[model samples]
Target chain A: MKTLYVQGNTWLHRLSPGLKLGGLAVFSLLLFATRSPVVLAAAVFLAGAIHASMRFGVVRTWQQLRVILLSISILTVFTLLLNGPADALAVFLRLVALAVLAATITATTSTAEFIDTITAGARPLERIGLVKAADLGLAIGLVVRFVPEVLARYEAIRDAHRARGLKQRPLTLAVPLIIQTLRHADEIAAAIDARGIRGQNNRKLGEGS
Target chain B: MATRDLVLAALFAAIIVALGLVPPIMLGFIPVPITAQSLGVMLAGVILGAKRGGLAVLLVLVLVAIGLPVLSGGRGGLATFVLPTAGYLVGWFFAAVAIGYCSERFVGRSQSALVQVTGFFMAAMIGGVVILHGLGILWLAYGTGTGLSTAFLGDLAFIPGDILKAAIAALAGRAVMVGYPLLPQRA
Candidate 1:
């Protein structure tokens, strides 16, 4: 998974990822805690201010927000039709507030910082043997590594099909795709095991420390 | 989990993200589009079984949480979780689990082609369509204050499309089973 984090020296960028994320959680709760349009309007104003302060420029900011704002607009329209104007305004303000704030956090935090934060959070789960933090981190790493490779393979397969003069469909393309990926996965698992990169082998390797 | 399971699950998660490359079919009535990614969830379920399939979806959600544009239409981040249609997105994991568990139980290695296809179809419809929609519609209604009737009506537009997706996923699941066979040997 690729993050669209812009390089910045802003105050939010200086803040730790965990704090930004924690604040996002708390702020979301508070936003939903109210049905008051005035409060939510204030929240939206504050969130928009923060977004503008990030200095992503108007086009960059709109590019970040346009997709979500589209959904928010539709949601507002539906709420207006179903629940009346008062409810619609509240919904609109609340969503805009949440979207901008979340986008701000996302834009500010780099991918490495986000992963480190997530891995730190996963540590507690690891301590309980629910998962090893290393393994969980590796899984996320593998996903990021694999997405582009899979997409590239997909285009190659599509090209192959075109060369063969076969019409492409989801099932036909997907079968080969899954088979190819699973084969790669098997080889990857073997490579990881051979390198003692997981489970007890790695644990024992670090045992002397 | 074994390293192999972890790797397999991660790879499937990537596949789910890759599915987002397909342009979504936007319905004029609903905020979200009819996405191929949901079919990826079903495929993972049917191909990997419950545990791994569910993990694959969970990992995808983690990517979304980290602000990756992994969802159809490249939508993601914390706000995506709170959208009116987000219930459907969240439902993907449970729906995969439902489909996986049912397909594992209903399909057998020695089963006739007809029986296997039938089993997969039923699994996808019951789990992918029914279970996903039940959770999704309720969330859209209660969580978003859309009113149950309004939410239900809005969801009806997608049911046919979802059913079609289930059919496609079912067929793909069967094909993968024949080609690769992964659920307890996917028997």
Candidate 2:
């Protein structure tokens, strides 16, 4: 899995994973509620401070944000053309602040801690029979881990196709990826079954009896 | 249904939510902003399969419904669905189902990366892009009082990004199967 979480020791890092996640959620809500540029600016400043505090390599953070920033710039120009300067600037700043804050959160928190927090938080929802929060947490962790791995595989396949001078046909790319994923799913299922990790409902029934 | 499977679904849902945290870019010509949420949706289907995949998507949608502001560009609310993008929001359920169904039914434990990729694309197109965009365009047409041609033109910008999302979904789906091999079994 391509882990986006960066390891670090900072105030933001020291904060409980649940707290940080909650803080992000709350702060983001505030931004949406007000839509005021001043509040948004304040939020952005706070986010930047936290991001800077992480002190992970400044260059790395910048690199990660380069694409995002570029997109924002393009968007600003386009929006300005259509909606005029004021609205464009407001949206642009809001987006930049939001992205920075989110990345800051990602940079400071470890994937494991984040997953734990989410699972712990979501556990209550199990009462509604919607899903077992713990199960959702584990699923989130696996998906997070899986993202980068999948991206890397995609690059390799694309490169192979390029090397073979095959046109970038969707079929050429799509079919193999699907087949490979199914195989992986099968293996994973078998592995889980072998370990006796049965359904949660079943486990609960066994426990209750 | 298995513990492992449920865990995987939650994890994928988280990934989808995380991707949503990324900011979106607004196009001048269209009201719909470009976002990473669709990529997350694509991943959900490809990784989680149809049934569980849809469930995973529901997990994220539930978060949004509860006012977590988990959508792309930090936009979230019950009312958010009333906007033009509402159709796409509703389409996610179907997209996840389509993506999962195709992967499990066609790809079927073969482990061929190519086949998985193909399945991912098919699922995403049938579920995520085509179905999603189809609904979105209709909504846009009706909501904005524009013709189908105009609505489609507005939606055209998303096609490239949606395709890219499909590719990423395929790659991520295959990698999980290979690396973890402990993902939950199909229900």
Candidate 3:
């Protein structure tokens, strides 16, 4: 999964990923714990201001959140019909605040920095033999890199389905997509084997110390 | 834990993330849209078995924890875990494990192709749909302050599409079992 990271020299960009993630966690917890519309609206205002402080202004941020807004609208309308406008407004504000805050962090933090922080965070888990920190880092990198590739393959399969004058049947689309994906996995497995990047082997090598 | 296993886990996780890129099939009647990502959960379980499949999903959840836009409609981050739909997201991990465990039991000894396919479909439905939706409804109720019955009724619209996903997962599972049996064999 590619992050929404864009290069910028703002202070938010300069902040450590750990701090950013930690702050996001604390802020989100507070948002969920409270139900007061006044409190929630204030939180939303603060979040929006923080987002504006980033290089990407409110307009672009709102543009990127079009899908989220749509989803929120659905929930908002449901709340409106079921509960009342008051409940709907509260839900809408809460969702918008949380989503924008998250998108801002992703937009500011580079992927490499994010992965580095994750690897550093995982180092403590190695004591319990949960996972090799380095292996976890590499695996995450592989996942991030591979998501777009698989999406591309999905597009290719969909186009082929279209070319065949087939109705966009989910079943037909899924079978080929899975087949192509596993085939690609086979190739990736072979490459990992060839590169000698085995996790167990690496653990063995580390144990020699 | 071998290189190949690690690669397989990562690859399947990527497939899960990739599935999220598909535009969700929105039904006007349902609050929750039909997303392709859940199918990846079924596929992982059917193809990779319990241990690796569970790990594959866990890996994706970790990515989500750190705020990657990996969920359908580009939703992610720690906040999402506290949202109403959070149960479905959390359910993915356990559902993969359940599907994988049941797939082994259901399909492990079946000789007839029909039985095997049925087993696959049943396993996917039991784990991927029933369990996931059950948890999803509970969370939706709590999140929205709605009654449990209301939430359960609200989720009924998902049944038809979810059954289709199960069928597709079953067919795909059978095809992989025959054409490319790379999954680790477990008792």
Candidate 4:
């Protein structure tokens, strides 16, 4: 989904997806473990600095963050109401910092890099018959391709409902949506079957047995 | 796994992400928006069964971890795992398994349509509402530094919407059962 990825060729874009993901994990863990507002504030500034260094322009970064920023803002009000200004401020800073830092990585890395890295990383588990790297990669690729298509279908369905002057009842929307999506899945499964992909898996298992 | 299973898992993973694009129905009481993605979780379980269903959700989580904005409200990345919603996200995997296991156990091929629908509804409620909310509230409290009781109190607002989702999941599950009968017939 383009909503998920922002294309760019900064220094951050050059790093391997594995390295980028690992670093993001460590950074998030540290943020979660630290409760201090000062540390979180500094983290926010550091995250911002990293984004600025990319020269990706603040506008695009903000564009990627519009929904998240609104969410954090709404959450800030709740935290303020439930806890206090100190907690609210800390929560806001932490969320903003993490979201921005994450946006930086997503903006830089390509989806292909992500899938390849995941497949490579999981290749080690093949020893136990628990991993099939190629299949895993293909599955991830299919998911990426289908998400937007499904979303478009959802819009079409919703439009149809609206045309009929149906109330925005979730039940009505969900029933048709679920049926259509599952039908699509069934077709894909049938297509795979026709392609003889499952034949390979069956033969491999037969040989192993 | 069969190639069909792999394709179904990926397809359901896409379904989960697609559900996130549905604009959340807000009730104004809770901070969390009423999103349709959770229904996708239930459907995955009901349609795919336990092992395949869990893998389907795990696939989505993997995509999210790699920084795809597949989550509701368009939020994703490693950062989401640290947020107050992290528990629900993590729970999605187990919830799928739990619901699928329950559905498979309680709703057999010989069962009547009414019984099958009831079974699906029960499975959805147990896993999607109870298990998911249990994990979600715990994480929300831990992440936000709120007391467990308070966090749970806040989560109460979601019950009404979640009940509706369970009902919808049940209806859809029954429809799939009649229309496609994807579950393998008894040996």
Highest lDDT scorer: 1
What tens-digit string does per-residue lDDT give for candidate 1 at A99-208? 89989898898877888998889899988878777776788889999999989888888889899998667777788888898777657877787787785655343332
- DockQ rank order: 1, 4, 3, 2
Q: Is model 1 an incorrect, acceptable, medium or high docking prediction?
A: acceptable
Residue by residue across A50-107, what tens digits does model 3's lDDT show?
8888868667676657766676787778778888888778788888888778777877
Task: Arrange candidates, best TM-score first.
Answer: 1, 4, 3, 2
Q: For candidate 2, give the docking quality class from DockQ.
A: incorrect
Interface C-alpha RMSD after superposing true interface residues, each candidate, one decimal: 4.7, 9.8, 4.8, 4.0
Worst 10 residues of 2 chain B by lDDT: B76-85
Candidate 3 per-residue lDDT over residues B1-187, each given as its tens digit: 5655676778889988988888874434545556778888998888777777887898899888766778887876555664666788899898899988889889964368898899889889988898889989988877766668877878897778888788878988887776666545451
The global C-alpha lDDT for each of the candidates, from Candidate 1 onward, is 0.83, 0.63, 0.78, 0.78
**Candidate 4 residue spans exceeding 4 A from truth:** A148-199, A203-209, B22-34, B182-187
Query: Could you tell me which 10 consecutive residues in candidate 1 chain B have the lowest summed lDDT?
Result: B24-33
Error of 1 at A112 (Å): 1.8
lDDT of 2 by residue, A100-143 (tens): 77666666666566557667777777777765676655454454
Local error of candidate 2 at residue A130 (angstroms):
2.6
List residue ranges in candidate 3 displaced over 4 A. Answer: A148-169, A184-187, A198-209, B22-35, B62-70, B73-82
TM-scores for all candidates? 0.91, 0.59, 0.84, 0.85
Place model 3 in a CAPRI quality band: acceptable
* Tens digit of per-residue lDDT, candidate 4, span B39-104: 889988887778788889999998887778788777776656656767888999989989888888
